[model samples]
Target: MARPRKPLLSRDRIVTTALALIDEEGLAALSTRRLAAELGVSGPSLYNHFATKEAILDAAADTVVGRVDLSMFRDGRDWRGALLAWGRSYRAALTEHPRLVPYLAVGPGLRPAGLRMADAVFGGMVEAGWPPAQATRIGALMRYFVTGSALGSFAAGFVGDAAAYDPADYPHLGQAHLLARHREQVDEGAFETGLRALVDGLALQYAELGAGKDDAQGGAKGAAAE
Candidate 1:
């Protein structure tokens, strides 16, 4: 048999096709057989690129993470500003792949792109004067908030029917029916609000640490004078 004129498969092609499958049919629809069929290749050909289905899923998930804007971290941007930008980008990327959030959340991020994201976030925080431990916690905190937001449908869960909430029993929820109508706006607003609060809280903590350091330095100076 003659060698093929064109390449049959590549890692990028595999991951991209897997992502398309997930985007169109949800994660459950992705399988080696289905992907191979989609790629116009035999199922065994996929194994040459990815060791297993889980490996392919991990690559797909990392590809989504790769879409996030991390440039803010490279330009000497203030910590809070960079973090806020990264958070919004992260959330937006994950929001587009809401079905994959669950898988991305639990993984160890063994892929190169995912590991680079982790490094940027952690290094950015430390460079911004956060203790290593605190920086780690902050990264985890953002991941938790963003991933949880991706999974939750506040509008869908809200009782949109007035009949569902009796005024006598639930006075506060009487106007809750309107919440469902503004799902997109409400969800985006809530995410932004929470992102601001988180960033502001971290900033305050950083300020307090600075103050503590100043106080300690002043105390040492007074002792030297005595």
Candidate 2:
């Protein structure tokens, strides 16, 4: 008896295949047919795993995030170091797949892996003495900065690309970029510096909050005695 047709495909396989195609041809060239061909499967078979190319791309994005090893944070390093490391790792993943950077640059669906990373970052912020609401907001800002830096770095490296970003119009930014021309303008150095600055700022905020809480508790005790 002929062996039943092997279950030939799965979502993970499809996402991995899609990412490979994206790495090869870029976001513009990715399509359901292209992905299926790359995976050695028929186009229709893709639908069983992903509803559309967008869905596949979304899955691929999440797959990239899912690959991150968050053990640095788990090992009890200070939040500053952990956050900087996380940002560096995230940027590295996107940088490795330059074509995938554009898709990540856009608004995409959040996946379980992305949510887990977000939770970890937010939890770290809270452990560092931030209020829940403040921690979430700060987490969003950090994400924005890291993503923006990655996209900018990728865009700058595009061959024959002009700085169409007229720094002339923004004197301060233009001057800053020009001044940093001699430095390693990559994401790692910038991410670490920015991350440390944020952590230092947060430290001041935390101290203020701690002082406020202590004052309030002391006031309550004094009032009880009076």
Candidate 3:
């Protein structure tokens, strides 16, 4: 018996498997040795690609963030639509990797995809006439909203075994199993509802700002005419 010469390893392969391990288990579940075993390579071999476990984690996080669609931001004619599209895609990516939300929620770190996403969002809003301060806040606001939605599914908490929730002690009233049947629908519905409300509020604010600007400009023009 003998081991393969190359040990069957690639940076992509290692990162993919590592992310899966973290997603299936948790952050603590990942280790250099565990990842090597999952990839069927020597533990020391992993160090050749990544200097440390943190590097691999960073790559994995970037992969998840990369799934988000940023194309909508290019639609300068409709910033609201672009924002809604961004929020939906961002939430979808995070929902797929719920376990990783905690780490990602803290910050983007030096991840390229994450940085690009921030840039696209902030730049799009600013280009659409939002003040710089507000544009910065919008990026942060959406990240918080999307990450919070994915952190722990509210529907999942109720959708469980028949007796998981006691009738007298809780609100579900033994309906946990029933809720379980529609967990996906409930959770998705909640995300959509919250996302729409946020965008709608922002739209109103944008309109108000536009009106204020027009008023100021008209007043100045009338005075100059006088």
TM-score of each: 0.90, 0.75, 0.89
Candidate 3 collision pairs: none
Model 2: lowest-lDDT 10 consecutive positions? 153-162
**Prediction 3 global C-alpha lDDT:** 0.89
lDDT of 2 by residue, 62-165 (tens): 88777766776688988777777887787777667767776776533567777888888888878877789998887787767767766645324433323633
Model 1 earns a TM-score of 0.90
Q: After superposition, how far is residue 181 of candidate 1 from its true place, in Å?
A: 2.2
Show the colliding residue pairs in model 1.
none
Predicted candidate 3 versus true structure: per-residue lDDT over 148-222, tens digit per residue = 999986766764676767777787576667765787888889889999999999999999999999999999999
Clashing residue pairs in candidate 2 (N, C-alpha, C atoms within 3 angstroms): none
- Please give the ranking of all candidate structures by lDDT, highest first, separated by commas: 3, 1, 2
Alpha-carbon RMSD of each model? 2.2, 4.8, 2.7
Taking all chains together, the TM-score of candidate 3 against the true structure is: 0.89
Name the better of 1 and 3 by TM-score. Answer: 1
Between candidates 1 and 2, which one is better according to lDDT? 1
